[model samples]
Target: MEMSNMPLGGHWVLVIIMIILATWVIYRYLAPQNAKEWRNAGLIQGFIIALYAEMYGFPLTIYLLTGFFGLEIPWLHMRGHLWSTLLGLGDVGAMIEMIIGLGLVILGLLLLARGWSQVYKAQKENRLVTDGLYTYVRHPQYTGIFLILFGQLVHWPTILTLLLFPVIVVAYIYLARQEESAMRKAFGQKYVEYMKRTRMFFPEIKNWKLLFKKG
Candidate 1:
């Protein structure tokens, strides 16, 4: 996977545009309520900037690692996909990255779409969203976003983004708490009952049979 002499790939404009478009989509079709919730979007955009900037504009992590650690880590390798080069899997690494990234991304977007759709319908009818994807997890939208951020890290693990990942997780966790507090006020005992039954972020594996039976 050593391609020290190779020129950098993954153009900056395309990556920037992709991030902008992603931000737009997140705001439009899959937005969370309140200004506090919007902070997640801002953090996500920061991650994207750090991610693609290194991904295309510069190999900051690679350079830093090679400079500080004095390890000859195949500079300019794998088009700034450090994870691939570091693993020494070469093409296999690239394929694994693509597969994992794509899988998580598709799953994330699907969850976001379905979760939001359910929420919208519930809101229209003046009911709390307790069915569909919400039956398994209280915050499928946040979970979707979490998956997307992790997926990007898997695709290309830059230093900045790796650091930003946990921050993003904590931000989402806080946001989820805030969201749940609001939901509790709106729905009262019903939401409390739902909370007692369902977990946030992760579904209960113990309820697999019941989940299979869900509509």
Candidate 2:
């Protein structure tokens, strides 16, 4: 369903419901209590809600400019299938981008799931994680989010979304850095040693091969 249709065809009532639901979902996932974590989580939640709202709730910018776009533009059809409109795809290309975007979304979700599971397990034992997805990126959760957002952008590049993309990207990058600082402080010299061997967002091939080398 188009995001704008979340309120059932620009219905204000439905939009309110979506806002409530989004708030609940973000609160649950972010789980922020303290000041710092709460602030960070708020930023994350805001980014998520903003993206989804524009994605499925309402393409207001698109609709508002339809008159200027000409009568034969078929804005309704495009709004109904919002992603297709943004990606500039016609038929097969649209299908391809949609499939790819869906794939990336699934992959991002899986990465998040796996990363969360690992962290939860470590916390249960009061240990630190330096393996699995963590071995590849210091912040797989943020990376997954970026991947998901990128996938969405590729699938649908609306004016509002496009404008917000860079800002969102910068914000996430800042958050990731903040998280790394906390982690480094906690892990101390061990983390310092690990940093020498790990890349923040990209995996080092030599390290990967060494870590996976067969005895």
Best by lDDT: 1
lDDT of 2 by residue, 176-210 (tens): 68777877899899988877877775467655444
Clashing pairs in 1: none
**Each model's C-alpha lDDT?**
0.77, 0.61
Instruction: Please provide, for model 1 over 61-98, each residue's C-alpha lDDT reduced to its tens digit, 9 standing for 90 to 100.
Output: 87888899775666554544666767777767777887
User: What's model 1's overall lDDT?
Assistant: 0.77
Clashing pairs in 2: 2-56, 3-56, 3-57, 3-58, 4-56, 4-57, 4-58
TM-score of each: 0.85, 0.71
lDDT of 2: 0.61
